[model samples]
Structure formats: C-alpha cells, structure tokens
Target: MYDSILVPTDGSEGAEAAARHGLNLATAFDSQIHFLSVVDERSYSSALADLDPTVGEQREGFEQQATEAVECLEEMVTEPPVTCQTAVKHGVPHEEIRSYAADHDIDLISMGTQGRTGLDRLLLGSVTERVVRTSDVPVLTTRHEPDRSRYDRILIPTDGSEAATAAIAHGVAIADRFDSTVHALSVVDVGGVVGAYDAGPGIPELIDSLEEECEQAVTVVEEECENRDIDIVTEVVQGPPYRAIQEYVDREGIDFVSMGTHGRTGLERYLIGSVTERTVRTSDVPVLTVR
Candidate 1:
C-alpha cells in the first residue's frame, strides 16, 4: 500500500541497514524510493562560528556529504530494481525528515534506530524518537541488518486500542504485500498487577481477567486479518509485555514487528507502552511504529 517510501540516512552502519530494508519494501510494493540526507545546520553552525569566512565552504562540504550518502543508497537499489530519488535538506534531522515526508506525501519513513555516534542514545536517536512521536505516517526502524528475504513471519502486538488498530492496518498491509503469515500476540501484564498490589492472594483471578482481555484483543486482530485475507496465528501469555514480545520474536523467528508508538491506556501496558520503548531498544529485527 505504500506509494513513496522515505529513507533518511547519515552514512552510519545503522542507516545502511535501514536503507537495505527500505529498498526491499519499496521493491515489494513496486513503489518509488526517496533517499534523504539532512544536514544538521545547527550542529555545523555551532561547531564553526557563522562569522568565520570558511563557514560557507563548510556548508557546501556538508551538502556534498549528504549527496554522497544518498548515492550509496541508490547504488544498492539495483537488485530489486526500484525507482529511486535523492535529496539533501538543511535543518534539524528529524524536522527535515518529517517535513519532507509531509510535503512529498510519503507513505512510510524507514530509518535506523541508532547512528554511528551518540545521535541515538540506545535504540534510536533524539531525532528518530521525536519523529516517531510526532510523524503522522508510520516509521520503520532497524538496529540490525535487514534479512533481505521476504519476511516469512510478521509479528503484530496489539492491545485493542485505537493506536493498535492503526498499527494493524500497517501490519496487514506489509504482510499482504509480502504474503507473510501474521502472528498476533497479546500479553497479560500480571507483573504490573502484582507490583501494584502487595498480596499475591488475588493474583490468579487478576491473571485470568488479563488473559480474557488478551483474548479480546487478539480477536480484534484476528478479525482484521480475516478481512484482509491474511493468515494469522494468535497467542496470549502472562508476563512483562516487552519481555513477552522479545521472547516471542526469538521463539517464533519473527522477522518484523508492527505496533503503535503509544497505546490508548497511556503509559500502562505494552504495544506503545513502556514495552514499545524497550522492544525497540532490544529487538533483533525491524520494528514498525505507527501512530
């Protein structure tokens, strides 16, 4: 369903990985690919005084670097034969990316969760984090090299919230495009409940209730999958949501994860809960965050 896919790069290893994955997706959808490398003008200007006579030359050098980074990505697009374009923008990295996506009608923005330096603290950079928080479109992030093979299994973690519903649409779109099987997971946060209460006497009943809720959540995902004519497998378990998702990804050989950046319950549960933040930091494959 993606029309124009944007891949913002800074010539980092992480960005290289994202470019591969983005190209794969574009090839699959037969969509146009746009490679954007934004020059952080603020960083350059601060590092080199604007009053300096050489400052203009330094800016030109930065633009040249951006062009070279985009060319590298373009060279990698030959195997699947996707239409590719490149651009260099000057501004804050995240804002430039968001603005380009909006102005260009980009369907998705695929980026690295980390950069060469401290741009990304752990999972993603401040720019990536801000884009994930504010972007109107889905943002696909990768911390590892892309598998390249068509995703055989795609994971969709849900909590039956509006945000999760939005994520489902993106997940189903990708799964449908690749003809991949969808695994819908709903985790019961029994640990959260136990932490909130001192006694374990009511833990069993609470766990049971959480499982019931999990079932309802997965049912919502199942119905969506059925509507899309995509194959689906469902699971419900009791544990910390992020751990549950990571464990499931490893256990089931999940190639990708699609979920919301924030959940309807706010900061309480997984699938955009704190769990999403943790999962992004630790996931071995790409994680797609839709808001």
Candidate 2:
C-alpha cells in the first residue's frame, strides 16, 4: 500500500506538519516518498511583476527559486528508511501537481491544508482541495500536527454508501500495515432538529425512527469487523452529519479519519466538496479521503 507517497509542499508551517507525517508513514511501510514543491506561476506573476526584468530573466529566477525550495525541504527531512526524491516545477500549482502524479503513477498523495481556507472565491476549490478532486488515487492530508502516539486507532466515517465501502478497503490496508485498531462510525443527519425551530407532537416517533435507523447502520459496520482480529468500535450519533463526526473525534480521541468521496462528477462535485471540505477544515487529526 502506498508504494510511493507524494507530498506537495509550499514551504508553509502547515506543509511542514504534513511532511513530517509523510516521513513517518514512509518509515512505517518501508515505502519511498517524493517531496515536491511547486512554485505557482500565479504567485510569481504577483511577486515579480514590479521587478522590471525581461521575461526570460523572470523565468530564470522563478525556476531557480523552485529548485532552491525543493533543496531546502530535502535538507529539513532527517528521517527516512525509504528513499526520498525532491523536485520542483513551474505552472499552476494544482494542475501541475495533478499532472505530475499522473505521469509518475503516484500511489497516494499526502498534502497539508491551512484548516481555515475553504474553496477560494475565484476557483471552484482550494488548491489542496482541487487535487483531491482530480487525483485518481487516495489522498492522505493533514493540516495540524500529527499525533505521535503511533496511529493506535483509526476512525472510519461512513453513511454505508458504496463509495464509503470502497474507502474502508483502503483504510483497512492502512490499519493492517500499522497494526492499529479500526473504529467505524455512522452519523445520522439530524440537522433538521437543530435550530430554534418548533416540533409537533410526532417528534418522539421521529426520534425513535432515527435511533432505529442508526442502530441498523452501526450493525452493518460491526458485521464488517466481526471476521477481523483487529479491535473495532462502532458508534452512532444524532446531529448534523459534520457535527456528529467532529464531536466523535473529540469524544473518542481518534488518531486519524478515513472517509470516502462520493466520487461525484460534474454537478455533483459541489456536493462532494461540502462534506470533505468540512471534515478537512475541521478535523484536528489527519484525514485520508478515498475516491
């Protein structure tokens, strides 16, 4: 699993946190890691616009800066049981990174996020968010410092949908590699109950029905874990889907989160982005989004 992990760094502290996590994963799996620092042409255009240099001179310096950043990142990486490769490219960061992953056949993409940045106003998605949309492989991303307790437990969030099931296979592979426990959770979307709204006399029946549905959902997860030797914990929470997940992570002390993208295409992308973006934007632990 993850024979070659690719990490895109922008020399930000958030990226530094993710780089360290990528290194640790490489160490665990004895798999190679690639550290790529792409210098976006847009950033260059903004910074060097007033330099008053010839176009060729600007390109030379941009290329040189990209090279130097990659070298600096390489020097910062101290631990590696697996081989590490470093390179830099010039172009739109997201598109260029996606193409690099495609050309190199990267197994998994590891990236860092700023946690608060959602979709950019101009672009449909954030750069980190956009790659997850386009990447054909799994993506493991972290915005916060990784908890070093050694991934003793992983949390899998599912709606019992087809895409979520596909996500579990990738997550189980990670658990098997790390010898960790896997916990599965189903969140009932009870957001309608939240707010200053009023409920009728049938409220009790609605709650009862929702609870029963949650129980059935948890049962499915339990059955999936029954044949495995790894310890599995299952839970069902009632609230907005995102709120339930965020609360569970804090309540259960989850080390990492494994989630599925509906693999929504065309118009559905806006929908898929809502769930994943909220999770990545809020989760304190690492998140692996499987498509």
Candidate 3:
C-alpha cells in the first residue's frame, strides 16, 4: 500500500538502521524511496556567525554532511526494481522532513527515533518527536538495528478512538502484505485510573467496566482483520498500556508495532500520556504511528 517511502537520515547509526528498514519495506511494496538529509540552519545562524569567524566554514561543512548522509542512504538501495531519489535541505530537520513528504506525496516517512547525537533514553529525540506529533502522514521509527526486515508478527494497540481506527487500517495493510499474524491488544490502565481518582469500594466495578471496554476496543480490530481474511489474536490486558504492550511484544516475539499517536481522553485515555511516544522511545522493533 505504500507507493512512496521517505527516509530522513543524519548519517547516524540509528538513522542507518532506520534506512535499512525503509529499504526493506520499499522492496516488499515495490515502492519508490526518497532519502532526505536536512542541515539545521540554526547551528550557523547570523547570531552565531557574529561570535565565530568560522561560521561560513561550519555552514559549508554542515551542507556537505547533509549531502553525504542522503548519498549513503541512496547507496543502500541495491534492488533494481525499487526506484530511489535523494535531496538535502537547509532548515529545521523536522520541518524540512514534513514539507518534503507533503511536497512529494510520500506515502510513509520512516526514520530513527534517535538522531546523530543520541537523545536521553527517557525521551524521544526532539526532532523525531516533533515530526511524529505534527506530521499528517504515518511515521515509522526505530532506535536500533532491525533484526529482520520482514515483520512476521505485528502488534496493534488500540483504545477505540478515531486515531486508533486510523492506526488499525495501516497496521492491517502492512500485516496483509507480509502475511503476518496480527495481535490486537487493549490495556485497562488500572494504574492510571487509581492515580487519577480515589480508589474506594467502587474500584472493582470500575475495573470490570474498563476491562469490558477494552474487550470491545480489540473486537473492532478483530473484525477488521477478519474482513481482510487475516489471522488475528485479540486480548484485553490490565496494566500501564505501554508496559503491557512491551510485555506482549516480548512474550509474543512481535517484530513490529502500530498504534495511534493519541486516543480517548480522561480515565479511558490509556493510549494518551503519549503512549505511542513511550512505545516509540523504548520499542526494540520499529513502531509505526498514525495520526
């Protein structure tokens, strides 16, 4: 379903890993691939130039690095059937990426969750986070080398919101392509509920109600998979959503994860706290997020 894929690089180990995964997807879909490297103009602005005499040289060096980054990604495309292109832009990294995707009608934007300069393990890379939060298109992110290009088992975490529905469609499409088993999971977020309000006599009934809601949430995903004749396993689990998802991935040997950037709010906002962000930051495999 991905006709055009975009891989934004910074010549980092993390970016290289993400590019390799993007190349794998392009091969599977026969999709055209575009590699983009952006030089942050803020690094060489006039204010910095006023303090440093070598600002001109720094700008040129940044431009060259950006050019080389995309060139490296372009070299990764060895398959003759997959078309590839490259470009370098001077702007904020995330903005340049978003503009390029929109301008080129990119079907997917895949990149590293961490940039060349590693980010804090607890936080997503700032640029990558900005792109994920703002981009209209789906973004796929990975922080480490991918073990295998093909996704044999895909996990879809849902919270029964419009955002979750969008994620389901993308996840199912990819699973259909790879003939992968789909795992549909919904978390009861007991921790969040107890933290937000008083845990009194009504807590048991509340948990039961939340579990039932979780079941219904995953059932929608089950129905969608059934329509496509795809094998799906559905479950409703109780815990912190992101932790539950990570546990599920490990227990099931899931190779990929797809979920929404946002979901239902309030006590049912199991998919909030940017659960997608937390998952993207910590997942061993690539996480594809749809808005």
- For residues 11-118, write the lDDT of model 2, one tens digit per residue: 666666777777777887887888887655664454655664675466666667556656766775576577888887777878877888888878888888752232
Encode model 1's per-residue lDDT on 34-135: one tens digit a residue.
Answer: 999988876457466467758767777777877888899888877645788899888888888999999999999998988756422212366777887889
TM-score of each: 0.91, 0.81, 0.93
| Candidate 3 structure lDDT | 0.87
Candidate 3 lDDT over 5-98, as tens digits, reads 9998888877888888888889888999999888887777756766776987777778888888888888888876899999988777788899
Q: Give me candidate 3's TM-score against the actual structure.
A: 0.93
Superposed Cα deviation of residue 290, candidate 1 (Å): 0.7
Question: Alpha-carbon error at 216 in model 3, in Å?
Answer: 1.0
Clashing pairs in 1: 120-125
lDDT: the better of candidates 2 and 3: 3
Model 1 ranges with Cα > 4 A deviation: 46-51, 79-81, 118-124, 200-203, 266-268
Ranking by lDDT: 3, 1, 2
Please, what is the whole-model Cα lDDT of each candidate in the order they appear?
Answer: 0.83, 0.70, 0.87
Candidate 2 regions off by >4 Å? 44-57, 76-80, 115-125, 192-220, 263-272
> Against the true structure, whose lDDT is highest?
3
Worst 10 residues of 3 by lDDT: 115-124
